[model samples]
Target: MIRQIFLALTLAAATALPVAAERIGDAARGATLFDRQCKACHQIGDGATNRVGPTLSNIFGRKAGTVAGFKYSKSITRMGADGLTWTLQTLDAYIENPKALVSGTRMNYRGMADASARADLMAFLRDYSDQPANIPESEPTARKSEPTLDPAILAIQGDPEYGAYLSSECSTCHRRDGADEGIPAITQWPPEDFVVAMHAYKSKLRPHPVMQMMASRLSNDEIAALAAYFATLE
Candidate 1:
């Protein structure tokens, strides 16, 4: 009777572990999914080298933006400095929505909405983990070159007065004092980065619905105006 009780308790403990802790997901299915979705930008497995994205070899348990020779966006670098490590949970969140996890990240992925698909991708990525010693010291290629903005657009001197009027729409969600609650703070961003980010949203590359809607309606000059105004925030 005591032996049966012990077995039941052990089974219960095993069943109670989180799905990620158990590493649930079919690696075979994950491989196929990776080929379909991630093969273009990222590379993995033996002889893998960085392409548009960093090589995924030994990615699990690695610190974000710490890969040598890779020029990461400031947002991801800041998150890494804040101790964001690549784990099953973190990677899952990032893969689900790049902008949601790291606002202003230059990764152009629109995000995977299917939970099962994300799980499979995570499984495929996990296969490349725990082999840091075996990774080759290859020079990383630049991750996707940014498109050049028109000089005319970049040179547009913003009207801060007009920007102040436009800012009434933005201040509802983003705090002027830079307190980041659920939404990220936009205050004090470099004007160029702010312009680029707004353009990305306008182009449907950033994948946030509200931001896309807001940016899509703004003219290039209006975007510049907003950028200039936001940059001046203390």
Candidate 2:
């Protein structure tokens, strides 16, 4: 009976292994990945502005039609005007398949197929964009020195300190430390890859109306600064 029981336990443990294999994105790793894969197109935080792509700063809670200057595809702009907010889940779905998420988005890059990779990248993005807070037990006294300009209207040549200041909006969907509400922390990505994404969005190669608006608003200088800022997030 003891041997039989032990075998059953072993089988149960074996069955649970796959569940544990689902690794979540770490902000540190996501940063690495972002640096290696994204810098070319995307930027967030500080003086970071939209470039070829829409600015990624505080993307979590933004409305779909927002982003200052990018001219989104007609469909996407309509979606935003209808009032669609980007939640973590929305981001995840969109990242997995940009075209599927927004039919008219101009992004030409295929989706990031790896769930873990996408999660890690997101975490890195959040960390790169947030403003530092004292985080007292009682709501860190609403951060001062926040940016008032629309993300799309902001310039792209980023200021690292400013990028850090702007990054605070990311906390709504991405967590700095670990997974939160199904949103994974990301830390690794490539800068070049990001830049390309921005370009795709700005050029309307990627079809997100909100992203296009944001991308159109940014200057190239702002894009580089945001990329540089995220590279250091981890």
Question: Which has the greatest TM-score?
Answer: 1
lDDT of 1 by residue, 79-168 (tens): 999999886567777887899899989889988876667767777777777643455442111111122356587788888788888989
lDDT of each: 0.73, 0.56
Cα lDDT of candidate 2 equals: 0.56
Q: What is the alpha-carbon RMSD of candidate 1 to the true structure?
A: 18.3
RMSD of each: 18.3, 24.7
Candidate 1 residues lying further than 4 Å off, grouped into runs, are 1-21, 131-234
Best model per lDDT: 1
Instruction: Give the range where candidate 1 is weakest over 10 consecutive residues by summed lDDT.
Output: 138-147
Q: Residue 128 of candidate 1: its Cα lDDT? A: 74
Candidate 2, residues 1-234: lDDT per residue as tens digits? 112211222323433332212222477888887777666787767787887777877665578867898766776688777876665456666777888778888776687777667768766665543333532222111111111223343334456675454445444555645355675453333554445455445555445566556666556565555555554676
